[model samples]
Structure formats: C-alpha cells, structure tokens
Target: MSLRNITEHTIALKDFQVQGDAIKTHPLSIGASTNRTVNGQQNPVIHIRPGETQLWRLANIGANIYYKLHLPGTRFHVIAQDGVPVGRAYAEDTLLIPAAARFDVLVQGGAPGTTRLETLPYNTGPAGNQFPRADLATVVTSGTPVTRAALPTDLGPYENLSHATIADRKIVVFTENKAGTIFYINGRTYDSSRTDFVSTLGTVEEWTVRNDSDEDHSFHLHTNHFQLMSTNGKAHDPTHGVYDTVNVPKRGAIVVRIHFRDFTGRTVYHCHILNHEDMGMMAVLDIVPPGARPRATHSG
Candidate 1:
C-alpha cells in the first residue's frame, strides 16, 4: 500500500509557495492505493484466511505529507525498511512514515471480518500542517480459520556502526527564512555548480543533522544508507537497522553514521519533502577514490 496527497486542483510545486512553514494550498485529500483505486473507490480488499499471515509492503510515496498508519486490533511485524531487511522483526501498532519511506511488515489475518486500514491524525509541529485521519484500505478475512503462522526469525545480519572507527564527522543543519518561502541546509541554498561535501570511498563517517526550523524535515541521502545513532540526544537501537531517510524534528537533532561503500560518484542529501527540496533545502556530495584529491568546485 502506498499513500499520497491529492489536491482539489493541480498545482505545481514551483507555484505553491510557503507561508509560516505551511504550504499555500493544503492537500484537499490524502489518497491511498492498494493497487490502482484511490480513496477506496472500489473498496479494495485484501482477502486472506483467518489466522494466516501475509507480507505487506507499505510506503509513503507522497511529496510532502506524512502518514501515521494504524490498523485497529492488529500489530505489524516490521521486517524491513527502505527495502533493506532488518536485524529482526519488531511489532508496531502504528507506523509513522514520512515521505519516501517504506516499511515491509508481516500481518496476520484476524477473525473472519472486515477492517479498515487507516491513517491517524498527525501534527508535524507548531509550524507545520495538521493531517487528518483517512482510511487507506479494507482488509477482509473470510476463509476458514487456519493455524497461525510463526513470525520469521533468522533475518539477515545488520551492521552496527556504534563502535566503528569514524574517519570523519560532519554537521548538517536545516533552516528556513522567517517567511518560509526559502529553505536551506548548512546556511546556504543549493547550488548545482557547487559541491558541499566530499568524502573518500570505503570510509565510515558520522553526521549530526540538526533541524533549526519550526517544522520537521525528513533527511534523506542518496547513494548509501545510514545507521541512526541517536536522535535528540537519545540513543537509538542499532538493531532497528539502517535507513536512507529519517525524520529530523523541529529544533532537534539526529546523529547518523554512514559507510561509504562500493559505489563512488556524486549524489545529493536533501529534505525528503519535495517542496522543501525544490525551495533549496539540499546539498551536493561527492565520493572520490581514496588518496585522490577532490575535483575543484564552488564551495557551498
């Protein structure tokens, strides 16, 4: 299942301005798709036998919205995130997914009845928009009851970067103008001609990402995944696994350690919110070969 925002009238991101950290046009509706139908138009259903388990891949593919998904009387056994398998499956009653995030979960069918998978109201912050509750899909279990399947064990191993030798550390800050028309990272707008950060391949580096603005920002990096070390000065369970995107709360900070593995090239790190990205909350990163000097470019 994927969730997205739908406006009453189509509006381009370039034309949609921000005021006080809120968009000029709030989404008229939040659309959910099991396959093709939107807003449960056809009442899309997931048919399963009672007590049987099925794997469900849920994703937040929207540009700027967040989904706090909930299925009453059901617990989601999360096994993976962003397509990467976790160290072990963990149960969650609600999932708070920001834009571009994905969660793969195992769901066991309940009694022979129908239930709605819905998103609960989520308030990003004082400066952000409040998203209301919306139903995403209908899950129907009608077949004869079956033996409950056991949740999977032996999920692949995950790397823990807590004690890794960090080659370097960087600080990334998210900020925005008072009017909220423009956004920034590290105090500057994105300049395509400039390279903001450079790192050597095969090195592990830690980054402290701070959100200075009044709203939340989903920090996302390209080319490699990162292990979240801590958020708001609180340590995170390394066993939760790595992710390509994470939420940076308003005026709070998160520390992530990343291993610059195999691929070497230029990529970007930015706010996953498309509007903020389009408004300039992004930076360029270049991974050069070890012992090689980085190419000259305008500094951000």
Candidate 2:
C-alpha cells in the first residue's frame, strides 16, 4: 500500500484508471488520490533552523513520470544532475526531473512556516496521461534562526563533447500510430536478436531523439549518461549539467552527445514508461570492442 501511494506522486500514476465518477468514486483502489501523504498519514517533517543550509539529494524511481520539483520561495542551488556532479551550482526555483533522474540541490531553510514539497501537474501531450497534483513531504523549522552556509563560488567548467569529434550520429523516434495498438521505437518492436545501434568502444556519438507521438516519453539509456546539445534547435548550454534520461516532448526533439566506455556488450535504450517498454518500445545498443569488427545493424 505504501509503495502504491508513493508511485501516485510519480509518472507511474498514469497506469491507474479512473473508474465511475472521478469526484466521488475512488480512482485508485489503494486510496492515494485523497491524501497525498503516505498511507493517508502525516508526512515526517524535516527540522532545520531558519536560514540553515541543507543538501538535498532527490531521485525519481517512477517507471514513467516527470516531476517539476518546485520550492516556491526556496531557491535550489543544484550542484549535480543525474549521477554526474556539475562543475558549479545551478540556481533555480523549479527543476524538471524525468523518470529515473537524480538531482543534488543545496537549499537554505528559510523563514519558519509550514511548507510542503509540492509537485504540480504536468501536461505530457494529447495522448499523455494526466498526473494529479500532490505533496511529497512537509518542511518544518526548529524555531531557531541561524546563518546560511557559504555557497560554493565555483566547482569547475562544464564542457560538452564537440560535434566535430562525434564518430557517429543516431536517431531515436517515438512512434504511436493512431491505428496501431502498441508503441514502437524506430518503427520496430524490441527483438533481442536485432541490434538497433552499434558504436565502437571508447568513442563518442551524437543522437537526435524525436517524439512523434501525441504524448511525452522519457528517453533513458543504460550504462551511460549524455550531454544535451540542443532542444528544438536551440543550443542548450552544457554548463547546466549532463543527464541520463530526458523528456522528449510531443512532437519535440533533442540532440545529445554520449560516450561508450569500459564495458562493451548489449545494453538498452527505451522509454521509461513501464507499460510502453513492456509493449515493445525498446531497442538494443551494441558497443563493439576496440579494434573489433562492427556487426551489421538491423535499424535505419
């Protein structure tokens, strides 16, 4: 029951169906929609003196959800995204966390008042699922005022792998045919015998992923992280940080650079949506060992 309640706060909530009247009859059998708290109980409160500093590490474990974490008055000095620590802190009030993404933020406990960690509803697209609004936890103060920690002035410089050095470029397409019943990647279903992408070990490549569907889908790669180069043709500064899974907006696109390192075997890239992945929306990536001959791929 606790597991189901927490998932409602994530993108995985899209799997639940609304039965009968949405207002009266419960949409979920686990009784999550009413009280966002765990098992309908009050959430544990974090104690901190006013103006005290805190380092928050957040991770999205949902199968397929996107949370735009908002702190309202509290500013988030993000130092890392995914597992890669940025060279410096990126300050913002709201951060977009896709499925399986991680973020490390530095926050200062501000004025003493009851405040909740809230997540607003995100519009995926015409075909995307509707996720409800909810609160994750409550923030409380110890009633004592304190000085804030000195913020880091500099971490280091963030550099993006240049396109000039890219040995190859791959395309990822999210397809949902109006007449088709299931999702697909690159116009094909997942088959272990088939390889969709192949690259030489220790080489970097560029990938342009497009969501041609009516809903949003998160593109997640296993065993590696990538740097975002541009979104819908706009250059995205690499200083923001690198990420593992990124949202492909409906009819939108992104270009990212990735490196194939160390281990060389078959891995995967797929939509973080559990149902979609289960229904054949995934592909295998083959990283050939250095000096080994590349295999003939089955994808265009």
Candidate 3:
C-alpha cells in the first residue's frame, strides 16, 4: 500500500465525438473532426480525488478510435506511452489511444464505484465484412451514473503476469480485403508495409498481434514504444504502467514492451483510421542499430 508519485489535476478531452460507422446509425463525429481520421470517440469523463494519483494527458487530436480505459473497481498504472516515460512498467485492464497519440494514465482513485470510458473499433471487418460499429460509453462518477448493469461482459483483466521475457518479438497481422476498406494493420496494403519493423538500437521488442480479420484491430506503433505486458492471455501488474495504443481485444493477443531508446528514422505505426490508413491500414518502423540488415521494400 505504498504507491507514491502523486500528481493531481490533469484530465482534458475537449469536445470529442464519434458515433458508430457501418452506414450511419450512430456515427457521431469530432474526435478531431474528419477527412479520413481513423474512428475515435467513445467516452470522455474527468474527475478524481478518492485517493489521488490522477494524471491524464490524452489527446488523439485526430480520431482513430480504439481505447479501452477502465476504473470500475480501480487498478491503474500506465506511466506513459505516446508521451514517453517508462523504464520498465506494466498494468492495463484496457488502454490504447491512437491517432496523433498521447497518453499518461495513473489513476489510483480509491473506492467510489463508476469508472468506465470505452471506445471500440480495433479492426472492424468480417461478420460478413463489417457492420456493428456501436460502442460509446463514458462514466467517471462522483455524483451520479455508477450503477453497474452492463459494460463488463468480458475482456478486462491483465494485471501483469511476468513480463513475458523478451529477446525479440514482432508479428502484427490484421486483414480486411475487398475494395472499400476500413481497417487492416498487417497484410501489406498501406503504402506497402509503410516502414515494416526495423529495430536494433537497444533492442527489447515484443509485439505478438494477430486479429484475424473479423473486426477489432488497434495495433499501433510509432518510434518504438511498448508496455502492455499482456492481454487475452492475462497479466498486467508488472506495474501496469506504460502504453501506446493497446486495445487489440477481440480475437485478443496484445503484448507490447519496447526499449529502443530515443527513436531513429521513419516512425509511423498505422491503423488509426484516416481511411483505414489511406485505404490499406499502415505500418513502418526502423529503429535499427544492431546487426543492420536494411533494404527490404516491397511493391507489387
């Protein structure tokens, strides 16, 4: 019961909206307004002071939707991810925010119930190709709204297992074929592997993602960032702190953990919506620095 690192007042998400998109029935907008903006907008509530430790700075200013923030019973710790700050941290019931990213969660607010902030669209596809994009729930109580009835069907529980010993791991494979695409992370579409993983510097990678098509694809990566020890298989308390876009909970299999030191060149980990990464999804990485093996670009 000794968790100190308290910093108060920090919860800002000004006007965000994104209501469901299949053909429109609940596709509110304004997660940053769109042009192609990758679906973003679910629940955005703020208010803390039950035990202190609230320091949030989330702003996906672009909207690509795929957040799974929680606080129901309270168990938070995700030091930093798109904002940097993690020497070796863990813990995540659900934390992923892509699209111009930005995260810094650490809620330890003691008992008081009500704490839900959901957003879905991991990689919507299958189910006959798509249709059923409707998930936007938000509740950060202090007064009203905290009556548990629905919103915890499953997919919640990864409090750190053992930091899956890593030497090197990367496999992000998400697909969505046809023509009118909307999601696809690893299947070679977005400008051809955008930058196709290339780490080395101080290597310490781990990304075992496989959302096999049928919707739910939020595999984001940019400038080598990781800290989501586990999900799907369970485990999230290695200090559940440090994240960068981890909402891959449908087919489920999220394992993020990196330490490539200060970025290198070409940094962009797509699938944040914007026309499904310009109609193909996206991928690109090159933090090279070990046994250099560059030169592997494809296009056919």
Candidate 4:
C-alpha cells in the first residue's frame, strides 16, 4: 500500500496515491510486494485443480489494514483461527479479518475459471481509521477434476474451557484520553515496570474486556489462545471455537475464558493497531507457576 503518498506521487507511473494534505489520516492503497520487485498491482497467481479441495490459510499480516475477504464463486469452510483448529468448521462467503488475525479455511474449487480474492471496504467508525477496498490476489483453476471428500467435522483433542472452574478474574477496559489523540488500557499505557495483569500457570481465568473508546479495537495476547464466552452480555455459539485475538467493538464488551497451561513467562496483550500499541495501549503480562513469586504485580 502507498502511504509514502503525495510527495512521491510524481515518481510513480499511475495515480495510485491518495490525494490529500492529511497523508497520515488518509486510507491506504493496496499493492503486492515480493522479494525482487514491488508490484503496484496484484500479479500473484494461485493454481488449483478444478475439483480439488485446498486448504487456504488467510492472514491479515498487515500492520493496520482490516480485510474482509470475499470470494464470489467459493465458500470457505473455516477450520482454524490464529493457527488453532476450531471445534467444527464454519461455512461462510465472507470473513472479516482484523490486523494480526488469521483464519485457516478449506475450499472446494469451482469450475475452471479465475477467482478473485478481494477485500471490501470497512468503516471502523468516524473516529477509527478507514481503509479502502482492494483486490488482494487471484486464483486460477485448471485441468480435469479430482476426487474430493467432504470436510471433516472433527478437530481432535481440543481443550474445552467452558466446564473448567475459573480461578481468576479480570476486567480490561479500553478508553481514550480527553484530548482524543492517545489510547489507554485500564487507564494507563505501556510501562514495562508496570505489568497490567499476571496470570498463573495451569489455571483458568475469565476476563471481561470492555471497549469504552469511540473507535473499534482488537485485543491480542502473545502466548495463550482464549475462548469467547460472551459478547455484549450474550453467550456465543459453542461451535464458534477459540481465538488468539478478537475484535472489541466500540463501547461494547467481550468475555473470554483462557487456560494458562504448560508455559510460564512474560508476555503482553495490546491493541492490534500498531500505532495504538506504540501510543500506550499495551501492557505486560507475566505468567508464573503456582508457586513462583519474584515479579511485580499489575499496576493498571
């Protein structure tokens, strides 16, 4: 995407740049960059057999873009989220992807033709950043059909935290400062000396996160994946599965249950928006074993 905007416009062949003095506030354009050369247009091609079922791994690896993927001729059987397999597959025509999120999907190829992987425009809010829609990539199917089987419904040996007793509890609130420029989590910013919350290893914790800000924000943790228990005071479908990161709607709340298992270290949770994190919407999380005691407590 061309954020190196207006000042560099004359250098490029096409008028692919957004025209404005508010370069920092304008939406970004899309472009595909590779190891050798950066293509202002998407020239990447994916080949597939007409009748084969392919596993498509979709990731919003971009730092700021939110891609809502749409494939007109295909249906995505979402099998995983953030590399963790879901309990069951979900069939959807479009999938919303925030920054730092991922989805593993199974797709049965349609008739021999080209399919465009496109991103529709998304409005986070008047206060949140808005990104223009753009085509991400293209997939072409050729050759004769191949034998295909139905999507497997089973995701093996996944932990069910719903039945687990909650050993700890926390409420994370996201809000903005009075000047409306910076973001705050739990009324504070990132301070390594100040850990926001400490979770013990081998325990289950239920957390409620509320977004008091005017813009949409996403909550992402480093180590453990969490299950969505509720959103805005309603329980989500059990089959919706787990996520490593989740979108916290403006002025709304989300409840998730997490199991700290087999790992003990310091990690962090922050808004996936890169600028937001740099602006103090991040905090440290220390996970210690049940008996260990050698660190600071949550100050925020």
**Global CA lDDT computed for model 1:** 0.79
Expressed as tens digits, the lDDT of each residue in 89-170 for candidate 1 is 7899998888888888877778889998777887777767776776666778888887777787558788999999999999
Give the per-residue lDDT digits (tens) of candidate 3, residues 1-300. Answer: 333454453443323433464333234431333222222333434565555455555556544444434445655455555666554444566655544556665655555556554443333434322222232334343543232211111223433324444667788876676434455666576554446767777657777887665555566666555677677777764543465665564566776777777756667776565545666677767676667777566643
Q: Identify the leading candidate in terms of TM-score.
A: 1
lDDT of 4 by residue, 19-105 (tens): 444323334322222111013344366677777777777776656556677877888888888888887778988988777888888
Misplaced by over 4 Å in model 3 are 1-63, 66-219, 226-268, 278-281, 286-292
Model 4 lowest lDDT segment of ten: 6-15
* Distance from true location, Cα of 28 in model 1, Å: 10
Q: State each model's C-alpha RMSD to the native.
A: 7.4, 6.8, 14.9, 8.7
lDDT per model vs. reference: 0.79, 0.72, 0.54, 0.73
As for TM-score, the candidate ahead, 1 or 2, is: 1
What's the residue-level lDDT of 207 in candidate 1? Answer: 97
> How high is each candidate's TM-score?
0.86, 0.83, 0.31, 0.82
Each candidate: how many clashes?
A: 0, 1, 31, 0
Indicate the TM-score of model 2: 0.83
Best by the lDDT measure: 1
Worst 10 residues of 2 by lDDT: 1-10
For candidate 4, give the lDDT.
0.73
TM-score of 1: 0.86
